[model samples]
Target: MRTTMKLDGADLLDLARGAAFLGTGGGGDPYVGRLMVQQCLDDGLTVEVIDPLDVPDDALVIPTAMMGAPTVLVEKIPSGEEAIASLRALEAHFGRRAFATMPIEIGGINSTIPLVVGARLGLPIVDADGMGRAFPELQMETFGVYGISGSPLCVTNEYGDSALIHGRDNKMMEWLARGAAIRMGGCAYIAEYGMSGADMKRTSIRNTLTLAMRIGRCLREAKDRHENPFDALLRLLPDTPYSYGRIIFKGKIVDMRRETRAGFSVGRARIEGLEGWDGLMEIEIQNENLIARLDGQVRAIVPDLICIMDSETAEPITTEQLRFGQRVTVLSVAVPAIMRSPEALDVFGPKGFGLTEPFTPIESIV
Candidate 1:
C-alpha cells in the first residue's frame, strides 16, 4: 500500500530538529531551510512526501541539495526562484518532467530545501534521501556509490544564473560542481542524479526524512515531559535500522581549529572531559563530524555517526557554531547496514577522509 504524508509549517520545525541531529554537527543549521519551507506553507502551497516504494518504477525522480560550505548554506537563505530554475533546467535538458523530488541528504537545510522545490513545482518530495545524514563531498552518496551518474546536474545561485554540467563520472561531476559552488559565492542549489523510481529504491537510503521528523518529535516530547532527551534518543533509534546509539563523551569544548578550505569547514575540536567522564575527546570535521577519538583511541569513525549535542537539551550543534566552553555530549550512532558495505565504505569510510585507520562501527568501539 502506498502512503503519503502532507507536511505543514509546524512539521518543518520537527523535521529541522531531527535533521540537525542527523547532520552530526554539520549540514548547516536548519533555520534557513525551516523558514523557506514555512514560507511555502504560508503561500498555501501543498507540500507532500511519498514513500520511495510508492513511486512508480518508471517515474522520473530527481534529487536536490546545496553545495559549498555548510556555514554558508545556513547563513544565506535565498528566494525559491533559483531552486525552481535549477529543476526546470534539468527537465529541459533531460526532456522528462519530474514525477517527484527528493533530498540528496537528510541533514540541515538540504533536507527541507527539496520541499521548497517540490511545493513550488507541484512535485511530491520522496521520503528517502541519498546519505542518511550529511557528508562533505558531492560524490559521497549511495547514489554515486551504486553507479548512478550525477551528470546532467543543474546548479543555480541567488543571482538567477545557473549552470548545467555533464561529467564523464560522478567524481568528476563533484569536482566540477565544487568549483562552480565556489564561484557562485561559496554556495548554490543543485538538482542532480536524475533517476527512475526504481533506481531510487535500489540505490538511495530510505525514509530518512520521516526518521528526521521522528527524532525531532522525540526530543521535543522528551523536553515537554521533563525527560532526559539523550535517553529519548537511545530509545528511538533502535527501532529503526540505525540499530544503536549512545552518548560517548560528555565535556566542554576546550579547543577548536576551523578554516574554510576547498569550500569545506575543515577542523578539529578537543573536548575536555567533565561530569566525571574521564579523558579528553576530539572530533575531526569536514562539513560533518567524521571521526572521534577518546584519549588517543579511535572511538567512532566515518560511515558511522559522531554527533555533538547540547548536554541539557539534546539540541545539535553545527561545526561552525562550536565555541570554547560549551558543555556538550557526543552521541555516536551506527549507520545502516547498507552504508557499511565494502563498496559504500570505500567512498565514505575513514580512508575516504584521509584517515588511515579502518572503518569501525560505534557499536563495537563505544
Candidate 2:
C-alpha cells in the first residue's frame, strides 16, 4: 500500500543531513535549504510527501531544482520565490495548474528546496526524484533517460529576473540553462522536466526521499546510542536500492583544485592516506564528485556515488568544502537499477563525463 508522510522541522533537519550524504559531494550545500524550510515550518506551513503511486495518472508533475555552480549558490541565496515563479511560468506555458511538485534530485539543497516550494504552493511532493543521487548536468536525469523532454524550462534568479527556454531536447535545455544561469549572476532556480504522473511513476527513482530520511535518522540514532554512525548507515542500505556501501579510503586532504567556471565548480582533489597507509587518492569534481582513484587505479566513477565524509562525525563534505589536512572517509554506493540500464548509462556513464575508461559498477570494483 502507498503511504504519505508530513515533514516537520525535525524531519527537515534529518532530510538535510541524509540528502547531503546522498549528494555524493555535490547538489550545492543544504544549509540555505534547511534555513528556508525551517522558516516555512516556523510559519506553520505543512509539507506533505505523497507516494508517486498515489498521484493521479493524469496529474501534471513539475520537477524543480537549482542550476549552476555550487559555490555560487552559497554566495547568492534565492529570494524564496524563484522556484515558485518558475513553476508559475511553466503553468502558464502549459496552460495547466501543476498537480504536484518533485525534486530534480534528492541531494543537498535540491532535496529541501522542493519541500519549501510544496509548502508555499500547498502542493504535495512526490516521494521520488530525477537523479537517485546528485549529477551535474540537466540531461543526466532519469526523466531524460526515460524519454521525457526538458524543454519549455523556466529559470529565475533572486532579483526577479526570469527566462524561459523552449529547447529541442534535454541537452539543448542544459546548454540554454547553463548560459542563462551564467547571465543571471551564476545561479538560478529552474523548473523543468515536467511529466505526467504516470510517466513520473515509471521514470523517477522511487522512494529516494524516504531513503534519505532513513539514512539521516540512522546516523542520528547511532550517534545518540554512542555507536558507529557508519555501521548504522551500512545497516540501512540493504533496505534501499543502494544495497552496497564501503569506505574505500581513509585519508587527509593534501591538495584541492577547484574553480567556478562556465556555471560549474570544476576541479580535482588529492588526499594522502593516514594512519600508516602511505597511499594517495585523487577525486575529480564537477559540481559533484565524479571520479576517484586510489594509488593510480580508478575506484569509483560518475553515475555511481562517491561521498567524502568526516571520519569521526560522518558529516558529508562537499566538493567546494574540501580543505587541506581534514581527515575524511571516502565511501561509494552503487547507483539504482534504473540508472544501470544501457540507455541510462549512455547519458551518465563514464563516456558521458568524457572519461576514456568504461563504466564499472561500484559493487564489482569494491
Residue-by-residue lDDT tens digits, candidate 1, 1-366: 577899976689899999998888777768888998999898999999999999999999988888889777656777767778888899888898999999998899889889999999899999998988899988899999998898989999999888999889888898998889899988888999999999999998899999999999999999999999899889998899899998899999999998889888899999999999999998999999998999989988997889999887789988888999999999899989889999999998888889988987787884
Candidate 1 — which residues are off by over 4 angstroms? none
Q: What is each predicted model's overall lDDT from 0 to 1?
A: 0.89, 0.90
* Candidate 2 C-alpha lDDT tens digits along 1-366: 576898887788788889999999889888889999888888999889999999998999998889899999888988569999999999999999999999999889999888889999999999999999999999999999999999889999988899999878889989999999999999899999888999999999998888888888888999999999988887788778998888788899999889999899999889999866669999999899988999889999888889999998998888878898899989898878999999999998889889888888888894
How far residue 234's Cα lies from its native spot in candidate 2, in Å, is 1.4
TM-score of each: 0.98, 0.98
Q: How many residue pairs clash (N, CA or C atoms closer than 3 angstroms) in each of the candidate models, in the order given? A: 0, 0
Q: Lowest lDDT 10-mer window, candidate 1? A: 71-80
Q: After superposition, how far is residue 364 of candidate 1 from its true place, in Å?
A: 1.1
